[model samples]
Target: MSEPLLSADAWTDRLFSDGWVKPSGGVIAVQEPATETVLTQVGRADRSDVARAAASAKAAQPAWAALTADARQAILLRAADLLVEHAPDLAPWIMRESGSVAAKAAVELEHAAGFVRQAGAMATEAAGLVLPSSPGKTSIARRVPLGVVAVISPFNFPLVLSIRAVAPALATGNAVVLKPDPRTPISGGFLIARVFEAAGLPAGLLHVLPGDAEAGDALCRDPNIAMVAFTGSTGAGRKVGEVAGAHLKKVALELGGKNPLIILDDADPDVAASNAAWGAWLHQGQVCMTAGRLLVQRGIHDAVVERLAAKAGHLPVGDPMRGDVALGPLISRGQLDRVHAIVSDTVADGARLVAGGTHKGLCYAPTVLTGVAPGMRAFEEEIFGPIAAVTVFDDLDEAARLANDGPYGLSAGIISGSVGRAMTLGAKLEVGHLHINDQTVDAGPHSPFGGMKASGNGTRISGPANLDEFTTWRWETVKAAATAYPF
Candidate 1:
């Protein structure tokens, strides 16, 4: 038989700690969703692999933390440069493994590199605080790494999500045991190891273990792993949180969202439609902050819905390797099926399908739904696909209520000509990230990115905020005068 274009032989035996080595777990084939072709095979880690990785991370933590912050900063900056330099080689793998278009692949790589640089800058920005003390006594409080962190990232935007957590954990002087979703192991797992190693990171500092749920559970339950940083669905996050809580481990979660985008009466329908398309269809709407629900003012509801339907019809859904294709195949057949089922159910429940909804294989067309109301599955649940469900609001009060009614509070957006009006409405919506005259898909390397309530565990995971997730505070006090004890 002819060899596969991307072979398992290249990654099946790979494990990085102290350097690239072999893992004990066997391998599983990774398929390309666009063609259902075997793109490659990746090593499958088990509990023993997780234990070994955790041990390696724990062993390296002390020395890695002992290095001066400036030294660590330099290393991370170098890794950032290396990420950009190697992006071209890595982008194709990302495209094949995750079914990302060329443009989307490039964006993910760029954002990942920017994340590393931001984390590098954070290395020197803040350390701790000094407090005033009583006479003959000094008090100092500082942040320190939480020994080892276990990072479990999802398949969507695999490289960026994984690296964002990994970079910040490393920047804060903590070692990481990363468990990338098994489906995108090469780009999500082994590639991270190569980049950091090329940047001269020490051995045993970062371990990449590509595995399934069992591996993730083992990582979460490991006593040596001081904390867990995860980005995935709320369902999976809840299970992870349960494990972490049972073991009393620190955990940070970036979970699902059923976000909203509101259009004011005075807003331009064309502008709102443009923003809606960008926010709802980017990355095939697989993003946690995708604007799945749109609240349009009654005055412009029909016009905005028509414009969005036209936009959806025009988006190209084809092979991700093609330059003209805007929407690509989903990451797996399961996700494609789930999205299609939701769209079907919503339509059966009286929601109007204004535009595309069917799929050919894993490629689903950009979909738009109208006449969706409260108490309906389409309006209440998260559709992690290129589907935008629209509802009309009579006034600002109703719009704010509809926006805040959902269980998710990850992100929301408003488009209004008046800045004051937008601000007022934005204040009333309960969300972690709010955008004015924009869409809910906005994110930046230095931005504090996360959600509130079920969307997250009260932790933000970008810029300096991420440091809090990976480290703990220690207070020290010294007394120059000997004190007499009651004992």
Candidate 2:
């Protein structure tokens, strides 16, 4: 067993700018969603703080970018090592702050570390290309870092989400201002700062400010910030894109998802049911890539639904810190109400509640809904809760239609014994990520992760995508230069 990250008497109360500093926007009470207890109070950033942070990042970026790639890589690799070393403490902190079960918390920590390491390796990758040019001496295109970037991450998987953008941005030679959701600031914001600080990253290269909408808006509108990387609800992402775009700043929006898990007739019903349950209930279905709808071929729909309901009914739900539970509480009372409202509305709209549609405090039980149709809320909306909305489809065409019907195209999965058939069906779906014989809720540190249509702006994060997201291209024409001018 590992000790908790923050002791009762010692709490993180400051935000990180050039160094740890008290914020001007007062403080936000960080609560344990499972128990509704105030775990700590963290400093909140207002517009003024955003300006200062942005200015600091802008000022530091040039010097940081000027460093050798090996130097930058060394720093990022150290940060990755630090995350692994601190995982015992950090995992428990994530479990408490984000309402993640122990397994999920551990997985998030692992993913975070992997992302940082991958980003570090990216530093040494080819940063430019030789271009074919008109009869000049030489021509080249080089990737240069954006001056300063604003990274806005959500609460559900805060550590992974925040680091996915921050690590890559830093590795690509950009400074970052991180705005983590206030709910899990410790895990989302301060933890990254601590890791980097321990890794000996220079001051002002990174800033972690836990703030509200105003602070985020300020970051988007701030003249000093060159780009914005956002991961959150579609509505919030749209706003960030709009504001950032109006300022002519580059933006990467990894938004919401109404992902689908399609179970074909050939798939084993019990196995498919188990996969669906894991995809829908992991981290209480708070993940953006969670299977929002389970579209089953009519042949196996009944059997799959039955097994899924049984699993949902038996899976444990409780405070993660207090018990070994399969599913933990939703982030807050408001989120719980929203999830319940969708469930109740879907049930009223003729969807059958097969099992588990109740709550104890903030902990909502794993719910299974059957007879869910296309128009029902359960089938269409991204219900960020532990509810499996099962809908029956007649054939491959119908399955494809149902899976592609939603506005979001973040992720989709097809479970079929025939890999060829699953791959064929997967190719037809309008999704950014498609998995054959697997669940929708999956991501890798080295994969290009993003969405399509309303889910995002088609900009990806991680792997090679980071080069495009965090940097811009500068085309340089050289040698015998004066003879090249035509104008």
Candidate 3:
């Protein structure tokens, strides 16, 4: 069978250019998750480069903001059209950089491309409300772009998280400076820059700098940036949030999650089992909002585990670029170690390996563990990999209590016979978003996405709610005829 991926020659000749010069510290090679091969090398950014990029964005932002919102909307609409055509190629880049599967990467790219169109259409909804007052008195409030915005994207789903900031910032007419994961720069910042340029966005408005943590620290602390959006670990998110607070700027912190999947005794075992397994294994369970802990009613835990095990076994584990691949490898050796350590620690602490927790090179098996105790790190920490933990509980109240035990509140799912109980459970959970009878991570573009508690700040990216995140409101109270300040 011919492997489906760009050849080394083709990658060098077509996928990228000499623009991304390698850094001295490391070449920042893009790795193929399925094959464990180096795809390409990209440059790294330091404080100097990041600051320069941010300054450039600040300089270009005014002109971009001056451009009519309709003009920006046209660019977004065009980007969406271009994305549908380029999914095949773009998907591979994401796979190489982010360790996302080709099929899943296509979803992220397509969503990213359409994000502009969707967000642009939301321009009409950007209108501010009018306050009620005297007759002939009118108050008009409008959303204005915050100048230069810094975006820091993590290794897991690098392109999607980066674009989460880029699409909105550009669509809303704010210039963006993107700081992608240092380990996976070529496929992220560089590729995204190319895509936007191909879509006809102004050059200076969008700049890419692949850099280390120091570069990120510089970006967050920059006074020129009016806003910042970050996606990664909860500890990292807190650090960025602290810097943002220091600057007194708007920051969107999309952090970690220890999301739970609750299966009621009366819920359909087959459906719950299938959904829980899929949720745990999708993208090899690297997603921040992945449902890592499975809490099933004792009445159905055994059945659910059996079915979930079968489902996990059936998922094809292979290279991400291949169409049939259901899961890919972790982003790097460090990630692999972290994932393995967590699973091992939990087992040592008395958890039983139910289905997975085995690794073959970069490919970690879709793991399912049971009999997890509260003392285990896996029980408290974010799994961030394809290891599912099944913990049995007797009742709905107890299930909810255990689900909300973690400091993270990114997302959670509930499967139950009663819609009322499901809704009630959703509210009781501390998560920013709850998935009822489904995966914790949402796929569609229309959904308002964010986390709550330690999982996130008041930041939503693409929905009607998200429109407000990228903009600052300005209210003008002009007289019906003419109003003047009384001196």
By lDDT, the best candidate is 2
Per-residue alpha-carbon lDDT of candidate 3 for residues 201-226, written as tens digits (9 for 90 to 100) = 87678877766788788888887898
The candidate with the higher TM-score, 2 or 3, is 2
Q: Rate residue 106 of model 3 by lDDT.
A: 74
Q: Write candidate 2's Cα lDDT for 1-487 as tens digits.
A: 3343344343356788987788899989999898899988888999999999999999999999999999999999998888888788888789989999999999998999999999999999999999998775688999999899999999999999999999999999999999999998889988898888778889999999999999999999999999999999999999999999999999999999999999999999989999999999998999999999999888998999999988987899999998889999999999999999999999999989999999999999999999999889998889999989999998888888899997999999999999999988988899999999999988979999999999999999988788888889999888774753677
How far off is residue 125 in model 3, in Å? 3.9
- Which portions of model 2 show Cα errors greater than 4 Å? 1-12, 134-136, 480-487
What does the lDDT read for residue 296 in candidate 1?
A: 94
TM-score-based ranking: 2, 1, 3
The TM-score values for the models, in the order shown, are: 0.96, 0.97, 0.91
In model 1, residue pairs whose N, Cα or C atoms come closer than 3 Å (at least 3 residues apart or on different chains), thus clashing, are 18-203, 18-204
Tell me the RMSD of model 2 versus the true structure. Answer: 1.9
The weakest ten consecutive residues by lDDT in model 3 span 10-19
Which ten residues in a row are the worst by lDDT in model 1?
Answer: 1-10
